[model samples]
Target: MAIGRAKIKSVGAAQSPLLGAAMFTPAVLYILLLVAGPFFLAIFYAFSDARIGNTEMHYVGLENFRSILKSPSFRIAIRNSFIFTICSQIVVIVGANILAIALEKTFRGRGFIRFLILLPWVAPIALGAIGWKWILDSIYSVISWVLVALHFYKPFNAPMWLGEPHLAIASVLLVHSWRLMPFSTVILLAGRTAIPKDIPEAAAVDGAGFWRTQFQIIIPMMRPILSVAVLFGLIFTFTDMTVVYILTAGGPFDSTQTLPSLAFAMGIQGSDLAAGAAISLFLVPLLIIIAYFMLRVAHRAEVN
Candidate 1:
């Protein structure tokens, strides 16, 4: 009986590695098929003259890249992409910090308020953008209607939220900020709660005021969490096209054209696949750098 049990134990141990491999196989296949495959294909398409109707492609080297670089719209798209991403991140981080702090305190209706705040992040992007588009429409805008009713401006001369270039850019920025703020807020809130209650109480005992405690102690402690939030926000905002496409369509003379939107316009909409691919390739290097730093921060946080 003892010898039989020993043999069974050996068989079980031998199956362990095979079992682990079986569990991991699906994830590896998923990444290869969906992530790596598309990435390498994009690189191939970017290098070749791949048009929508073309049955064959020829290697054009850097021609597509050069053509996009010389285009004025491409330059504008790059500029606007940076502007929207940076500005929206700043807004999201600051606003999220504030919201997180406020939500940390117990108050009446706190749960309901959190639900309302999270609605934007939970809802589909297309739906949110479409809602904002109607809200900011020139003639039927609720904001303009309210202003006109209060005699802020003439009915016919109401401010055009999406009609003017600066306004359109601002509108797009607002939508981006709105969509991302709740997600960052949740991240920050989790960070804040993860902190031991003793730290802040000890700071209070030392006569540290709210601002001093927050800026000096709380913020520094939450650095890793903040890095994760900011990096994720940057990637999401940088790569997003649905919001821009639905809200402004990069309109008002292309004042709000972002890299992703321009890529869609040139590649899919314009039928110049190679040019579109080239435009999208610009995003890869920046994203990879951000992802590397994010992983580093996460590792450090885990170690500490």
Candidate 2:
């Protein structure tokens, strides 16, 4: 009897992991169907001849990818995607860090300020971009009027923020960062509060000044959350389309076009489905590398 009881206990313990995995099976299946499945289809289409307005697909065997590689616009889109992602991530991360620190302090109207800070994130991106579109309009821009009123810019004249090449790219980055910084700020704020006050207090007693304590103790402790914020920011900014579509439409001679927008134009608008799939898959390699690094960083931070 004692032997039988021990055998039963061992059997139950051995099944626990299997049961746990079974519990998560639904989520696993959902991701496979909705995310991984579509991605595999896109990868397949990238190598095939799948034109828009056609129900038939023929295997072209790398012709689509070869054509994409030979296209000048593909190169331009790749460059624009990198520039936009890097610039927006820098602006958003820095802005969020400063804002998070400010919000950590107890001050008058702090609650109201926090509410206002998050308004951009709450607002729909399409709506926000459309609003910015008018504000950046060459003829009837209130921002232009305000600048003219300040005598800092010329009156009765404004460069088309969405029409000029450099200005349009800058405008897209500014809008993307503006809409995303609040979420990063909230994440960093959570990280800040998670830190034990005694740690910083002990560092202060060790003759560490404000900046020294922040660098030595605070940032190290906040590393995990910051990594999360940066990873999220990089992915979203890298693939964003709504801001560019509503504001610039890849205009000023397609100088402002990023990969996502280019993909949309090719697949949906231009009816070059195979080429679009190739463009869409172009970033997969970079995204996989980034995700791996982010996981490693997160794991290391947690272990430390």
Candidate 3:
């Protein structure tokens, strides 16, 4: 009986890997179909002379990429994309860390405060951008009206939040930061909570002041999670188009145009699908490179 039971157990154990593969097969197929299919299609479009309003696509070699690279507008879009992503991430990291630290502390109505902070992240980007547009409207801006009421600026002279290049970029950056902050804050808060309680207490016992402990111990130990937060923030901000589309739509003389916005304009609106695909492809390589380095650093931090 014992020998028979042992044989049955061995057979069951032998099937475990197969069972796990079966369970994961559905997800793998789903990703390949939905995620990879579109990606491969985009790659094909980038290399071909695919245009809107026309079904024919011919092999164009590197023509689309070369044209986009040589285009002055494309260059400007690249610059604006970098600026928007970097500035927003800077704001996100600093603001998120501070907010996370504060929120992680026990307090009255902590849940409510967290919910309010998370609203911007949970809300749909398009919907949120529309709300912000109303607040920053050119003609009937609440901010402009409030400023005028406070004697900060004259009527009809309020700053054009989306009409001026500098102001437009700044507004987009602020909006992106607002959207990403809650997510980053939550990530950092989880990092903070994951930390062993004894570390902070020991730091205090060692006469480490608030600044010293935060800078020297807590921050260093949280490197992995911080890198992840920043990585996510970079990816989101770098690839984002919704906020820009609804808020500014790469307005004020293409000054606020990022790669995604420019692609939308040229590919969809201008009917140069190949060029738009090429423009969007510019981000993929850069993103992959960044993610690789960041992940390497994060891995090292974890090992340490």
Candidate 4:
């Protein structure tokens, strides 16, 4: 009986490595097929004279990059991408923190409130953006109707949320913030819950007020979680074209154009695949740097 049990244990140990590899194979294939394949294809297209419906291609070196560099719309798209991403992140972090704090406390209807808050993030982004489009429409806007009823503006003179350049940009930023805030809030709320209950109780006993406890004690403890939230938010906001595409279509003369939207407009819509690929590649370096620093912060927090 002892020898039979020993033989079974040896067989289990021998199969463990194969079991792990079998489980991991799907994820590896997924990345290669879905992620790495497109990445490499984009690189090839960026360097070659590739265009939509082209039957043949030739290596163009830096020609595509040079061509896009001279376009004024490219510069504007780059500027708008940064503005929307940074501004939305700031708004999301602050708003999410407030929401997380409020929801941390037990209250009546908390679950229902949380579900309502999470709706924007959980719903398809295109659907949310389309809804926002109607809400911000120039003539038939619900917001404009409310404003006119409140005498904030005349019936015909209501602000053009998606028409004027500045307002269009603001409208896009608002949509981005609204979509991202709930995700950040859930992350922060989870982080808050992970803190030992005794830590805050001790702070209270030591006469530390709410602000002091939050800023000094709670916030510092959540550095890793905050870093993760900001990293994901940055990537989502930076690469997102749905909100801008659906809301403004980079309209009012491309005031709300972002890099992703510009890439789509140039590559897919305009049929200049090479130029679009090159424009899309511009996002790689900035994202890499952001990811590196954010990951380092997360690692340091883990160590400490």
Q: Write the per-residue lDDT of candidate 4 for residues 1-304, one digit (tens) a residue.
A: 9999999889879997998799999999999999899889999999999888988999999998898889888999999999999999999999999999999999999999999999999999999999999999989999999999999998799999999999999999999999999999999999999999999999999999999999999999998899889999999999999999999888879778889999999999999898899999999999999889887977887798
lDDT tens digits, residue span 39-69, model 1 = 8888999999999988999999999999999
The whole-model lDDT of each prediction reads: 0.94, 0.88, 0.91, 0.94
Best of the two (2, 4) by TM-score: 4
Clashing pairs in 2: none
In order of appearance, the predictions have TM-scores of 0.93, 0.87, 0.89, 0.91
RMSD of each: 3.0, 4.0, 3.2, 2.8
Worst 10 contiguous positions by lDDT, candidate 4: 293-302
Least accurate 10 contiguous residues by lDDT in model 2: 155-164
Rank the candidate models, highest lDDT first: 1, 4, 3, 2
| Candidate 4 lDDT score at position 11 | 88
Which ranges in model 3 have alpha carbons more than 4 Å from their true place? 1-22, 293-304
The order of the candidates by TM-score, greatest first, is 1, 4, 3, 2
Q: Which ranges of candidate 4 are over 4 A from the true structure?
A: 1-9, 12-22, 297-304
Clashes within 3 Å, all models in order: 0, 0, 0, 0
What does the lDDT come to for candidate 4? Answer: 0.94
How many collisions between residues are there in candidate 1?
0
Q: Cα deviation in Å at residue 240, candidate 3? A: 0.8
Please report how far candidate 1 places residue 151 from its true position, in Å. Answer: 1.5
Per-residue CA lDDT of model 2 for 1-304, tens digit only, reads 9999999889979997998799999999999999999899898888888887799988888888888889887888899999988888899888898998899989999999999999989988889889999989978888889888988788876667777888888888888889899999999999999998899899999999999998888988888888889888889888888988888888878888889999998888999888889899988998998899888987887797
